[model samples]
Target chain A: MPTFADRLAEAVRQKGPLCVGIDPRWESLPKAIRDPLRDELPEERAAIGYFEFGRKVLELVRPFSGVVKPQAAFFEQIGPNGMEMLQLLLREARLLGFVTVLDAKRGDIASTATAYADAAFAGCTVDGDSFPVWDADALTVNPYLGRDAVEPFLTAAKKADRGTFVLVRTSNPGAGLFQDLVCNGQPVYRHVAAEVANWNAPTRGACGLGDVGAVVGATHPKELAELRAAMPDVWLLVPGYGAQGGTAADVKVAYRPDGLGAIVNSSRGVTFPFHPDDPDWEAKIVAAAQKAAAELKP
Target chain B: MPTFADRLAEAVRQKGPLCVGIDPRWESLPKAIRDPLRDELPEERAAIGYFEFGRKVLELVRPFSGVVKPQAAFFEQIGPNGMEMLQLLLREARLLGFVTVLDAKRGDIASTATAYADAAFAGCTVDGDSFPVWDADALTVNPYLGRDAVEPFLTAAKKADRGTFVLVRTSNPGAGLFQDLVCNGQPVYRHVAAEVANWNAPTRGACGLGDVGAVVGATHPKELAELRAAMPDVWLLVPGYGAQGGTAADVKVAYRPDGLGAIVNSSRGVTFPFHPDDPDWEAKIVAAAQKAAAELKP
Candidate 1:
């Protein structure tokens, strides 16, 4: 099996850099989808809707996108059944040749972190064959506990041939309140970016990007450029495009000159299509995402 | 409903300052316990063994400890069945009169964070009357995503009268590498500590502690003092007391002179009996924990 970095790089090359986000926003689905869900309980609606929508999304974007980032919170909101559906969705995505990134921002002490890595990547079964269904190719991780906490994920990823994207700079408005704080004349996020690069050094893929990646928000264009420069070998998973107020131009700096180093994610922008009176929401989303990808093309 | 601060304060007064961590390390259980689990599948053993051990732990510790911190990753490792057992264990802890701290360390963007908080503290049901059990009284949260990510937990916590402990100065060796970075000539964690105080101010209990709390490692005695001083209103959850190499003296600074402001945690130290020769591990654990609590008594 090709490493996550190699797979992601190959996808970007084939799909012109578009990575669709499978957000499964219940309220945003078409009325045909929403009407049936209205009668079901919130939990049932979310679970069934998420599975149906997620599978449709995978099929819809399979021809146009390289990877699919599933927001874990949406699935988790519906309870364990939703999680079961998420597992099935991940399997479907893998079958469709899309790299799966499970967006679970989990961080803990070393021992617990190891357990989380085992849960997300390596099967938890003692025999390994009859494990849980949903093991993503990559996962989003929180780096708050510093290097020791993150080391377990790295070790697990190395052993499992999986990948992790550490939160260095987020796209949310309040992110700058702490993440952008300058410590000794260098931003805290910059320090995290440097660490991400260092962690990825030994795991550099055939494409030169490392298995360990950094999540640098597209909303911070200047920081995106600087972080990209700082972590040349690290794959950048940039969120906050479209609905998060980031333009395609804002995300351009995240990619390498060759356009193979970054995967820009748009969650609500692609998933929620019932914003106004747009007749063909799905087609519009596909076009918008393709356009965004085109704008970021090298 | 009593706020988390009020409940915690009352518990502390009733059962000393010891907060036992219910980490069901698979390797540490007795031969009778391990013998049944040795050949069973991981999922089956995790479901049966973990629930049985955890239920017994809750029953045993309820009379002595104020709170039981069930590490989420341990149960999560076994998949959906493991999660079901976690819910059962949480229910058992509450039934036995011990406050449950779900040590998930989850942090994410806005909407997602709300779902996690709801799943852990507030029950969400689907089709049947049976809902996913909200077993925890409080939860451990990661602060990497900044204030927005944390606000959802705080919102739900205030509404449900629950609480959260944000990761601040951790016990691990590499904690200072990122947390201690001098941002604008002040350590980053100090800023987080201040925010914790501010967040807790609105939910202060009669005992002068806030519902919002900070997780500070007891190993850093000096920083613990400084963090204690910085976040006077916030309850401090001090980990790193035993196996992580922190003593009663090291944790003393976290509490006020009245011994009313902090809860020091010891997981493996209290749970895993030192002498295999001891006939009863439960009795040994209770005695050792009682001794530790007495040493910390003001």
Candidate 2:
């Protein structure tokens, strides 16, 4: 099986570097979607609404997007039923031939890390039986626990032929509070970038990028470009491109000159492209996705 | 409602500093307990077995322990069914007057962080309907995403009168890989320690401690004492007491002179006290909890 980097590269080549983010906020969803969330305590109705939106979005973006990043917290917010919906939607996205990045940001160490990897990728295990749980092609990881914490997830991704994006320099306003603090006369994110490159080096696919990737905020174009130079052969998953005040030009430097090193994500900016009252909400979502895809063209 | 700091201080004063960890590893369960895992899929049998072990452990430790730290990854490995079991265990512990700390290590930014805080402390919401998911008294947070990542959690915790423990120096060997790096002429964790104090300062309860706490490993005795003084008003949730090899004397310095600053944790040491084959395993678990409580009595 081809690694996630290879698959992602193929997707990018076919559909440009656009990856739709399925972050279904309740208030952002149109009434048609939100009306069905009036179910009982189990959130069965809400789960259906959430999955329906994602299912529709997957279909809408299938022609324009190569990958989809579903924010786990959003689905997880609706409870286990919502998680059930997440699993179903992810499986649907995979079946539709989109490389799915489950935005879980899970981090831990040793066996704990292994358990999370199991739940995220290969599935859960019982006495002697293994059950497929969240079938994500890739996952977002936090590297706070160091090498041991990240190694298990990497190993699991290798086994499953999937991938991971390590949070390097996040896009939020307060990200620099700690990530940009000087360490060895450089920001701390630089050290993490070095480690991410080290982790990626051992397993480069035919695309020259490894299953290991880094998430450098598109909002920080200067840092993104610096990190891009610092860590070649690393696939960058750039967020904050649209909704988070990052322009297409700001993210241009994150890509290789040949335009194959990065994938730009526009979540709400593209997905929730209309006011809730817009009767043409679904049409707007599709139009927005197409425009965003074009804007991120390499 | 009283703040988590006030409640935790009272619990410690009543039952000493011992916080029993309910980390139910499926492989670690006795043969009798693991016998019921013959169900098809959905991890129903496995969830039941995990919950059974946890229920027994909670009963065994309830009398001697002031608090319980349930490692979320263990339960999460079993999938949503396991998460449901986690909610039940946490609720049971809360009903029995235990200060439950969900060791989730979750971190994110903006609304994503809010969703996680909701899942951890309050509950998942759908429109106006709130599903009581975890209902933990407090949660362990990963601070790698900086202040914004942590602020939503702090806000949600305050709303629920709950609390948070930010990871400073973890108990694992590889924790120092990034945490100990010299940043601005000091170890990186020192910077994190300062921020934890900054976060803690605003929420000081009558006990002279705040709802925002720091998790400094008991293994690093010198660092523990230094962090204690550096964040005097911040409560310390010290792991690495028994199984991780931090001796009683090593963690003695983690506490204030008046014995009110820290709570020592012993997961496997207290929870998994005997070999699975031991006939008197339950008694041994109780004895271990009692011994650990005495050791951490300060």
Candidate 3:
């Protein structure tokens, strides 16, 4: 099996490093998609509409993108049945040869962290042929509790040849309130950037990049450049490119000169373009996403 | 509706601030409990055993404790069915008048954070009378993504009268690696501690305590005292008191003179006491927990 780094490198090389986000926002979907969530029983809503929409998303994005980042909260909001559907969607994506990054953003103490790593990466197998099809090639992790909290995910990723993207800097308006807070006159995010580089030291891939990565929001262009420079050997999962006011130019700082170090993500901008408007939403979205990906190409 | 601080205060007053953690270690259970997990199909091993063991645990401790900290990762590791069961168990514990602290430790950016808050406090209800019962009065949050990551929880918590415990000084050995790293000469956790105080400023309860809380591992006694002083208005969820090698004396720093500021947690120390050599596990374990509670009481 190709390591996640090798697979990501190959995909980025083939598809221009654009990673679409699958966030099935009920309010933003077309009438055809939104009706079921609004009208059906909760369980039926998850099993029928949610499942179909997620599957359609997988099918739609598979032909064009290098990877798909599925925001776990959107699926989890519908409860366990929604998660079951997520597993199905992940299996389908994997079968189609698309990398799935489970954007769970999970962080906890050691034991709990180990359990989450096990849950997300190694799904239980049922009958001789029935296996739990987990949808992620890598997971998004929070680095709050320090190195110990992150070590379990790193250990699991190493064992399974998977990957992790630790949140070093986010794109939200209030992100700076804490992340940019100066301690000893330097921003806290810089400290996190250094830690991300340190954690990935042991897991360097054949391309000299580590399986561990950092999530540096495109919203902070200057910080992205600084963080990129700080962690040269780490892969970057850059979010907040389109809807969050981050332009293609802003995201470019996240990439290396070779355009191989970063995977830029756009969630609501691509997944839910039809909210409160657009007569031909799906077509409009597909076109918009393709355009966005093109504009973002190195 | 009683505010989280008020409810927590009432529970503590009634139950002596003893917070029991429901961590179902499959290997430590009785033969009868272990039998089901061992004999069941691999797919059934975790979920069925989890629900059964979880229900038993709820029944056993419901009468004695003020709060139950159900480790979300344990149930989550068993898959969707386990999550569903965890929700059911949480509902059962609530009916028994025990506050539930779903130890999910989930943290993320804007919209994602809103979804998690909804899932934990104000659960989605398909029908008016029959809503999915969110089994937690409080939640453990990760503060890595800045204040924005935690703001959604605080918003929902204020509205719902729930509470959140942000990770501060942890019990793990490697906690100091990053959390203790000095930025401007003070440890990173000190910065987080001040934020906890800031976020809790407006939601002060009748007891003059705020719903926003901090998770200060009891193992770091001196740091706990410093953190306690830093966030005077915030409630403290002190873990590592028993199984993780923290003593009751070490945890006392988390409490106020009025005994209104903290809840000490003991997971493995109280739950899985029958480790082959220990005689009279249940009685001994119960006695130890009671003793620890008494020792910490003001």
Best by TM-score: 2
Relative to the real complex, the DockQ score for model 2 comes to: 0.67
**Candidate 3 local Cα displacement, residue A175, angstroms:** 1.5
1 against 3, candidate with superior lDDT: 1
Best by lDDT: 2
Q: Residue A208 deviation, candidate 3, in Å?
A: 2.8
- Tens digits of per-residue lDDT for model 3 on A13-62? 88877888877755555667655466667655645565676677666655
| Candidate DockQ scores, in order | 0.54, 0.67, 0.53
Badly placed stretches (over 4 Å) of model 1 are A29-45, A125-133, A275-296, B37-41, B125-135, B274-279
Worst 10 residues of 2 chain A by lDDT: A34-43
Q: After superposition, how far is residue B278 of candidate 3 from its true place, in Å?
A: 9.3
Each candidate's iRMS in angstroms? 2.6, 1.6, 3.1
Residue-level lDDT of model 1, residues A146-231, one tens digit each, is 99999999998889899999999998878987798888778889889888989999998899888999998888888889988899
- The CA lDDT at B72 in model 1 is 79
- Tens-digit lDDT track of model 2 for B199-251: 99999999999999999888888899899889999999999888788999999
B1-298 per-residue lDDT for model 3 (tens digits): 8889889999898887778888875555555655645667665675676677667666665545788898988777667777777888888888888888988888887878887887788865443422353637998998877787889989988777799999888888778866876766678889888888989899898988989999999888999999888898889998888878888778888888888798988887767767634556556556656665667676
Docking class of 2: medium
Docking tier of model 1: it is medium
> What clash count goes with each model?
1, 0, 4
**Which run of 10 residues does model 3 chain B get worst, by summed lDDT?**
B126-135
